[model samples]
Target: MKKYSALLILGILFLILAACGSNDNSESSGGSGDSAPASNGNASSEKENQEEPAITNAIIRVAMKSEVDSLDPYQASATDTGIMMDNVFDGLFDTDENGELIPNLASDYQISEDNLTYTFTLIENATFHNGEDFTAEDVVYSYSRLAGLETGEPLSDKWAVVENVEATGDYEVKVTLKSVDSGFLARTIIAILPEGYEEQETHPIGAGPFKFVDYRPGQSLLLERNDDYYMEDKVPQAAEIEFVLMPDTQTAVLALQAGDIDIIPGVNAQQLMQLDDSVTTLSGPSNMPVIFGLNHAVEPLNDINVRKAINLAIDKDEIINTVMQGSATKIDSNFSPAMAFFYEDSVEGYYETDVEAAKELLAEAGYPDGFDLKMTVPSHATMYTDSAQIIADQLGKANINVTLDPVEWSTWLEQVYTDFNHESTIIGLTGKIDPYDVLIRFVDGYSRNFINYNNAEYNEMIEKAILETDDNERATHYKRAQEILAEDAASVFIMDPDSNTVMRDGVTGLKHYPIGKLNLEDLSITK
Candidate 1:
């Protein structure tokens, strides 16, 4: 019996070795088996069971004029910068497809009876890309970091209302404000950073659908989809997203035409008109207002009559038609048409081609001899150059000698904000959802307020409107503020041009936001 058992074990071992050798040979030969029908049948069955593509593997190439400066949302200075950060990082609250504020990181939020306090309840399943669970601590960390109470540069005016933020529970945060701010909800559009986020020096970990893969400064930023994202159902259509930075609009347009890029966000009017039929243009009413900014610190600008003369001198209709190429519409007030309640039609605009009236105002301001003024502008931007030339021509008609000083954007921003080298310049400002945001950034005591146009009464009214809980009263206050700005002629409220985006034929599911963000999550390549 022992001899028989030994023989059987040897036979079993030989069989196992033979099977393994056959399997290895099959793999090596690329599964080419003619002798065994069963093996061939098994191979066919396995091939049929393979899953189809998830539509997430397709990479969508996009073109942008300016490179994303910072991944940190709170520190973003430009619209493109904010858009890039927004894609990889979500805020506690975000606007939905319908342009309404909806919950994002926070499951639900509520305001206190006095409107001075806000409570946010976090979603239990929300987790950062690093697998760290989100909590109220993260919210506190983000807000504090943005307020520059920690490591970031301070945004004093934006954070002035916040008294303190406390983690009342593990997933609940209560923020107590120094005063009631009606614009608090709108301001919460900033991205929420993770707790102890400052520890990360190289990259940031976010709870967004996409993760930052790499960034080549002045070149491009690469992002990949997060497979472990909490909302997998709303997954991005692409496996990877590449933001190739083409600073020059002409070069960007050429690249798009050559099929080197799929989309460009900041294509000017001339570039759009030159695009071939292969690309489709998407445009909408933007919050940005193109205007002529006056340096109130300058001698003549300090005089109301001089400011009014400058405002009356320009022919906005001609500028919009010629320089903007009919892509823009003349706006009477700084407030956008989208802001229905705050935008008062009663606030008259200076659109008429009143060369005679302009001359009259200039002469009335004791400039009958026509004074010479230096106008500084960013050379790269087409709109600024064209507007400056138009204004210079019109001012010449009024006998005002205007010298155009076109400089690079960096140099222009520095001189305009700090040096105050020039008396006036033509520029575009990205409008905010609320009137206070516009007023605070431009008219209030902020860095953008190089114009030095300030009124205690106007400021007080803006403050009241922001803190007022009643919607009707808030609208009334905002209207009054707009009236004050228009009456003073502190800034020339030029055209509010429509934002446009050109895309290739295959790209679909892309949507336009009023804020000018090109959302790519819903986009897919049908071709």
Candidate 2:
């Protein structure tokens, strides 16, 4: 299905380009005075044709519950931001619908036998949205900036494995790794930017199927088709795409029903139940892990017993059924099932709802009457805050007082996520196709580890996993890392939220990648 969708879009784009070329040739030939002059009737017909609308093209309006914090690909961390950037930027590689990494900007790549070095040959004639020619120097600069080669804060911990990125030739680049990282190739999905990406704070330009046209924060982001896109075959079918910010899922569903919006990236189960036959729904397991993060820096939560007590108090099954509406799967570890080789299924069912045992554990941790804990959950979705409420009630039975503090998405990202100043938070850790991308967060001193979950054993295991070249050996290390988290009750494990997209019945070509991105390049509207 994925291949078919891509190929069909390619064929359509080829036809569009061919017709454009034909028009150019005709205009050049007909403008010569050597040719016979057109009659008045012919001139009038040409004016009428100029005034006609391009009915073959489309403009798709997608709705999202929250607005993006940043449009910069390197700084974006939320699902909505990722989706927006995915359209405006072209990465070195992109995963298929099944999460297998494939070449995108790079025509082909090679890995050394020892797995310490990787070489890539760039696609010739590729140009950024600003018409700047792309070359290996741009790739080197992007990677260097991401890896903090200049001695500043890195954009993401995902770049920690890179030793250095150097351009060997105008169209060739080589990346030397500090160690053998099996997941490094997949993690190269980070979008390649122009040589200098600093000035793109307000608007970003990249070699993508679409170009940034306009953006109004808290309102809508507009993108237009990039006629000069590197992969001409991947030129967006939609002449324009408008991502409108929705206040909530209810408003979005209403818009879908009223024909105000064409699609919603994530439609909850309740919202799905409310939609009529006019809406078409598509669903799959998401790579994101919705976790109840407990800040280990806090007083009582610092104790493993308290963390275990809190973990055992809540019933994951109830949360999965009642709160999630059976649209998710219960997970005991941080790893999701979407990560085929590394996920450990047997680790589940280790902790069941046992109020008495939880009480005993809390008492043992010097919290007999249950200490108060402040939990801040992002107000992005009702599911998150509702799950926090249910968890508060469950912990209350074990005499653990949890205060629910709901904040806006921006505030949550600033306070709980960036600053790491909160006692606890309920947020989803969006995963990438690579296992290392998700596992790197739990490493000591990781910027994204806002919960301050630090364990020497966990950090060591993750490091070992990164250096291991063999697939099975790396899996063993990853499994051990998960086992350590489970044993220590690192976080209140939640479920992998199901990705449910609700679109108009005639909407087609909206591909849902397992990593929770909506591939809108090929999206089209049909009556």
Candidate 3:
């Protein structure tokens, strides 16, 4: 076995650990970028004068990438489910148009001097979808379910640091954390539900701008404007919203062209090329990292050499240009470059395309002939399937046989993400404003750690990042954590796919969230 010298290892770490500061309000923090046509701009505008259009319905039809798995806020981890949850549930805090964390359920909050405790004052007159008065108890109940503060069976560690949540007054809730975490506020985006109603999966009740109407399995979901919503000015401009599930991107494109669907919040670059002038696109900032995740618990993938070989065999630029149609920027680390604080430019070219080198590494791992690997891809998103094909082609050059298995969104969620039942998969992980959101998933035993990645050194660095009080020191720890993943080739890091939303010409006021959500609350029709 070869041993790395301490000084040599230190030198490499120093080179990658340079200060990469982040601006609090950078686009990476969250929210959509400027609204401009992603493709042929305003080509469909000419038809606007040609027809009198139908405006009597007052309903905006949206095309979702997949059928929603569950309305239960605790169970949903995918983007499609998050989209629906965004409308049905309101978090204690949410991002503004500029990506800054602002108050939602809690009108104002005060943090302790040590940053370990948070006291929140709820808004008066806020009511739930069922007309129940929203209070501090609801906040405590919702967060308790999310953080498992009281319940032993916690949903996710996304808010694991939350020690306790108690309602001191009718409209006041105080939360105490185990430690001081800078990103804790951003994680507060979890939906606040009524107490004891946490078990409701099929039917979700929350205080938001929209109210659930009906949901048909494998078909569509309908939501209507919540007339009792406290935020009158921000209420839905459209009377109703229908989210139609389109499993295939081609089918979705056809639907958009045929005027059956008014908007597709996220359209890949390849699909963007197919749309004509009639569709308007808003190209915005997205922190979602499309990764070729490998289950470290799996046989061949358990070998670091095999992982590095797989990473080197494929060309990221080629994938970006060909599969993404030059819409995305190649990323070597988990955090996007748009995220100024923890993203390091030096890590951009960590692994280069070296098919022969990859083959040699496989030979070193006792597989000179290479081996067959199955890549489970979710069929709902074209980016996943399209990128999977291109990746399979690239790996083929190194004699690695990749069998592309396309599965439905629900199947992929249960089998691939939740169960860790596959060898490899292609998927995107949406990031939050905080660097913790991106790094915490890679922790040894995190619920969201579907890839089953476990590294002692990585875990140590993350722990330090969480506890570090100094801004520069915290960022340095985050940089080291990313370096560990890159050095180990934790996953085949891919680009942060450009967030592209396609909406018909008649749709007005549609916007995209940087955290990867379509804001329909302010949407309306001009036709």
Candidate 4:
């Protein structure tokens, strides 16, 4: 293992992000370098053409990558599911156009001097979709259930450090953590439902800019504007928005060209090439790590030699150029370079394409002839399936027999992500405002530890990263964790796929978030 004797110390753990690779994460984060198009420059002209440029009741049809797996805010697992949850649920905190954490249900919040306690002043007029008033009790119910204080079955460690949650007043809630954690604000962005609201599986309710209308399996999810929303400034511009499931990128591109769909979010570079001048690309910042995951619980994968051999077997540069058409940022560590707070760039080019060396490593692991491995890919996301095919061929060169198992996104979520019933898979992990959310998934016993990786040194580093107050020291701990993941070959950390959204030339109000959500609150159509 190489030592990072000369570590680049980075401060400002705050993930105030805008475009994908910009120096600053401000409102104008997306610049010409990111290939992001200029803002709604013709917005004024379009307004003159219509009495209401931002139509109050206009419908903006969107493309969903897959069927929404679950309506429950807690069940948002994939990109499409997050998209659905973004509209139906409003959390205690929300993200701005540049991905900065902002007040949502909580109008204002104060952190204690020690940073262990958080006092929030809730929005008084906020109402749920079911016409229920949102209060501090609802916050207690939602967070307590997530922390396992209410259900007696802890779903996540989102509040693991939290010692208590109490409602001091009808509109005031205070959270006291055991220790200081600067990144605690990121966890507050998930949905805060009404107290004891449990019909989320069949029907969902929240206090976002939009209300649920209907959802048809394998078809679409419909949402209408929430007229009673407390935040009038951030109200939905369109009266209705429909998320139509379109798994195939080419088909979705065609639909967009035919004016059947208003927008296609997260389109790949190849799909961008297919669109003509009628539609423009809103290329924005992204911090997702598209990984070729290997379950450590599996037989051959449990062996570190086999894992390292698999890592050396494929060429990441080839995959990026062939499948992504150089539209992605090649990442060697689990973290993306866009998140400068913890991203370790020194590990880049650590593993070169060495097929013979990979074969030798396989022989060292007692597998003279590489064993067969099945890679489960979610078919809904074209990037995963397309990259899976290329990865299979690449691994085959080192005598590793590869088979592709493409499943629906929902099935992939349950089987691969939740059930831990897969050998290997290819998927993209979205980002958050804090590095904790990204690193926690790799913890051995974490709910999302589908990879089944376990390393004592790596685990200890992460534990220290969370507890460490000094930004330099905390980032150092995180850096070591990233180095360990690369050296240990935990997974084939690929690239941060550039976020590109396709929209008609005149359509505006498209903004890219660092967290990679296709927020539709500002979307509107203009002729």
Q: Estimate each model's TM-score.
A: 0.85, 0.88, 0.88, 0.90
Task: Rank candidates by lDDT, best first.
Answer: 4, 3, 2, 1
lDDT at residue 54 of model 1 (Cα atoms):
37
The whole-model C-alpha lDDT of candidate 4 against the native structure comes to 0.74
**Which portions of model 2 show Cα errors greater than 4 Å?**
1-55
Q: Give the per-residue lDDT of model 1 (tens digit) for 284-346.
A: 555466668777878777877777777777788888778766756577566665555566567
Clashes of 4: 2
**RMSD to truth, every model:** 18.9, 12.9, 8.4, 6.5
Error of 4 at 409 (Å): 1.9
- Where's the lowest-lDDT run of ten residues in candidate 4? 24-33
The most accurate candidate by TM-score is: 4
Model 4: lDDT of residue 375 = 93
lDDT of 2 at 299: 88
Model 4, runs deviating above 4 Å: 1-52
lDDT of 3 by residue, 500-523 (tens): 677887876655444655677866
Give the TM-score (vs. native) of candidate 4.
Answer: 0.90
Candidate 3 runs further than 4 Å off: 1-57
Q: Write one digit per residue (lDDT tens) for candidate 4, span 175-211.
A: 8888877667678888898898779877889999899
Weakest 10 consecutive residues, lDDT, candidate 2? Answer: 23-32
